[model samples]
Target chain A: MASLYLIGIGPGSMDNLTGLAVKKLNESSVIIGYKYYINLIRPILKNKEIIESEITNEVDRAERAVLEVLNGKTVSLVSSGDSGIYGMAGLALEIISKKNIDIDVHVIPGISALNSAAALLGSPIMNDFCSISLSTNLTPWNIIEKRIMNAAEADFVIIFYNPKSMRRQNGIVNAMEIIKRYRNESTPVGIVKNAYRDGQEVILTDIKSMDYNTIDMFSTVIIGNSQTYLYKDFMITPRGYSKKYEY
Target chain B: MASLYLIGIGPGSMDNLTGLAVKKLNESSVIIGYKYYINLIRPILKNKEIIESEITNEVDRAERAVLEVLNGKTVSLVSSGDSGIYGMAGLALEIISKKNIDIDVHVIPGISALNSAAALLGSPIMNDFCSISLSTNLTPWNIIEKRIMNAAEADFVIIFYNPKSMRRQNGIVNAMEIIKRYRNESTPVGIVKNAYRDGQEVILTDIKSMDYNTIDMFSTVIIGNSQTYLYKDFMITPRGYSKKYEY
Candidate 1:
């Protein structure tokens, strides 16, 4: 049986890549990933045949990767972030299962951008949180709106992925308005720009006090729940732990 | 002013670590982390001093790392998972802020255990999810129960970290019972043993069908929400996409 490795390269860091992922990348003759993501790993790839695609062309990459793996060459498909989190792992598995190529598919997990971005800012994710991508690529805005409302109603910490681009800069404002409909305006908000990257910047603000215009495509916004507090300049979402609670 | 780097190592992988994190790691001369995590990257240390500790010793590690960084050495205190997710980034900040360290604190983001365990289990974490660590070291069970209730009520995809050990083998069963209070028995559950490492196994079961006695310390379990489905040997927590409104 032929084999395929669906590798998660993490949030663009070489060391954060697992030993297994690196071994697969080195052993596999063919590598498939988004062109931008491919560019990030070109320096590390050792004489591998790379297949790069655009962002919206996930199915094409999966198809090509499966075909390449079926040809009896150790082929590896790469995905930026955890791949399971809004990345190409699911789509690849779907296509692979559909093809039924007697291939042993291996998935090596990596860090998602949200966790990386959240780490860049303090403990904004220490509470019960939900991650919602603002892009309407797969789900409808109404359902997205309802999820946002449910998040707001439940006072769950909210992590907004794919926050904005030139065409959809207004979606974040709409999300904030909906959140404010149920949550307090003083709820803490954390914006991580290019988190875990060269030009990283972290901003801690509030829902009502946010300057929406400052955010962009590379930024991820983490809005804290009602009980989240800002202590010693850190955005802390208390897990409700401490010695005082031990009765 | 001296600075301390609170770096999230992201599941014992170098390539899975971020470029920004690598930059900070490169700058630091003293490294502090669990002995195993430090040993994972021993080749890259290049003669850097390491203060390795056991995984459970948090406050002591933070104090020692802070002291090293305060003494004019650039110290890198590493944590598995995102640094702030039950990690040392916050605890370090809390200690340093009180000591007047006049230090620059940088948190380098890494891959978290939730995403790693999820990716190992095929498409298990595709929808709304919350992560709860059953290690009640400092966190109380009452708050953990509330989070479980909230997750069950929201029908969120739930990932249980540190699920079972020799002493705490019943954590998942207790959590499942709490979840069953709000969720049904048919919800899909996935358990990934030894996630992101050698000898990893992914188990696909459900709330009513799972056996807790078989799990060990290395296992991380995930429970799918109401809309979750299993198709072609892959678990999917559909985000309510692929179904459009009839206008």
Candidate 2:
């Protein structure tokens, strides 16, 4: 159909790629993505026109992918996690809409970092949860702070993405301070670096004992709700089944 | 090493299953899940001991799967979506912890209904988001209301699961009223039923114009944030990319 397939490659592991994602990648004539993400799925990107760009060139990559679809080429635009969540799907769709281009677009869902990280650290996000990206590259720090505060106040299990970068280091620290106002210092936090990928590291710590040095741009940090607790090496959040059932 | 694999089958579509999930399912001697979810993946259940339970028997299914693993059988306990989120992973892990079972447990992530629904609805959850289950069977209604109000007040994109059932129907209506206090009545809301599966339905409507009749337990409803907008047949939430870069 000469469509633009916005595919999420899942985490870094090829084994985590959904069967639908693999089929779409096979059907795509060209692949477009950030250079790091492109490398993650390079094993399956054979005989395709691979378009790699810098991490900051999201708009350029999105525009190029849409233009390729306009040129009657089946294009696959890849994102590291779920394409629709903090990924390229919105940008590409926005570009197509603003340009008033008529084209077929398929948004393929994937196992996002939230799902991947949660599984690795037992089940810390078993109940109501909210995800806030700490990257101020696009969103204002104030808005991010408000989200952290409100999510904490609501007692929602919170996940922090892009917690720390080389240039911006205090986002997580500031965020934890705001969360502490609503939660206790003993709240369990699960941190996964390079989830399901090479050099993958999983750590279970509390709010007071979390080591910021272990976190980076690639890490996903999960702060549990009031009910969350650490048992052995796994962080567990009961989905309130105990209140209803005898489990 | 008879490990218990808690696997997410990814919203009733075999094509959405991850490679690792397939591998684990093939490796297992027994498969346990709800009857509906087990039927969804019947093609892959060949030569395996199948254990299907009613929808309300999650703890039973989890306990049975754990018992099978304890009896030296590799068991795959399947969930329709990501197991860690409103699924069987937490329950199984909790049971194991409480019983002090020394068994290998591997949790495999999958494309959850949230991820699948967001993709079908076209990027409605690109920004910060929270998911709240509307069912009061396990959680108190007051707690659910508090989450809805706080998520809305925080301006996080909200995803509603278990929106409606035969016995309880006013959850979505009451939730909308609370959200209306914080958001405009015209806020974009996307609804997807049986996402990526047979009888799949995707509707793009606004807060004031939503059709509650189309929603059921199988439906996932997404209410957009302030920045979300409707264009063509798709609902989109900009990742605030326009504020930093021109598109």
Candidate 3:
């Protein structure tokens, strides 16, 4: 039974990898992923053939993984976070569909960056939340701006992925400006960089105090909704629990 | 050391549980959770004290877990999915904050219902997405409606948690109507019931064809964005990859 396993290794930490993900990795003889992601799970890569690709080469990597499965191999394509969310699963499935390949594709989910960052920041996304990526390499900035404005207006806890890059520094600044129109300047914000991995940094700030320069592609930025508050260095969006219950 | 571990057990399956969550559960002297969620991991509950509570008693549950920690007993509070997302993490943190308790709270992230449902539905949330719980238990219907409309207007892949319950049945219908205003009637929708658990059910339908009667609190419904399409039973929302690359 040849198959392709799209596994989320979970925010660059082997401890965050699920038992099922580890089992699939052990079952497969070959594992493919981005170079840094491969390094994150190197402890489990013993005696396994590894294919590491560079960033921005997603299509090539997904195509190669699909081709390996087509060639009667049990292949694993690993991603840093949940494979289904902004990871390799979608690209691999699309390639399989377009090429008319007959094979099993199992998406084994893991702790996404969103989940890991939220945990590190102390439950900043316990309510209705939306995740928007600020990378304009694929998505246009106009659409991203609209999402920021809409998310703020709806009063949803908002998570920003790829908030800043070396070349695209102004996206976060522009997005913040749009969101500030709807949210208060004192709303709590959490910035988590390299969550669950080495040099992990967690910063609790507010809309008016967050330094955009500290954010990069690796940072996950969560802006609290109107009711969100900061208590004792922890950022929390209440999930409206306080509105109805006494704790 | 006395500490409280807020752990997400990853949607009712031991196989989905991360190694860190299991280690924390092992380190704790007392494990607390809702009855159903506790039963999901009963296999590992051997020789461990378990406190099972009824539904709608979240404040009581969180308080007990916090008190156990304050009494110098290591405690683990488990949730079905990621604790930071509509789970026990926020409630426990708030209790700790308001009481001014000096305790270490470690949030172990897990595969949330959104992640598990998206994986079962085959990358339906690969693009920008928002999760809104239709449970009016704590959140008002009007607020939920506004979130749904804004999510639709922003063209985001939308995930509905607690889509329906025994007492409330009309939220799903009203939400679908609002979403249809911005999306096409033929937009792909994926419904996953009891994901990764026993007797799991997965259905792929369109906005117009989805049976609202079949949904309940145990179900997670994913409505795709404008660019989403179904490929041989798999619902996928492209991450603007095809617009820039060829496979």
Measured by DockQ, the strongest candidate is: 2
- What is candidate 2's lDDT per residue for B1-247, written digit by digit as tens? 9999999999988899999999999999999999999999999889999999999898899999998998999999999899999999999999988888899998999899899999999999899999999988889999999999889988999999999998899999999999999999999999999998899999999999998898998999999999999988899999888787787
Task: Judging by DockQ, tell me the better candidate of 1 and 3.
Answer: 3
> How would you encode candidate 2's per-residue C-alpha lDDT over A137-209 as one tens digit per residue?
9899999999998899889999998999989999999999999899999999999999999999999999999
Model 2: interface root-mean-square deviation in Å: 0.8
For the second chain, the TM-scores of the candidates in order are 0.91, 0.99, 0.98
Clashing residue pairs in candidate 2, if any?
A: none
Candidates, DockQ: 0.34, 0.88, 0.86
Model 3 in CAPRI terms: which quality?
Answer: high
**Judged by lDDT against the true structure, how good is candidate 2?**
0.93
Q: Write down the TM-score of model 3's second chain.
A: 0.98
Best-to-worst TM-score order: 2, 3, 1
Assess every candidate by TM-score.
0.85, 0.99, 0.99
Model 1 residue B147 CA deviation (Å) reads 2.9
Model 3: reference contacts kept, as a fraction: 0.82
Native contacts kept, each candidate: 0.41, 0.88, 0.82
Poorest 10 consecutive residues by lDDT, candidate 2 chain B: B238-247
Off-target runs (Cα >4 Å) in candidate 2 are none
Decoy 2 TM-score against native:
0.99
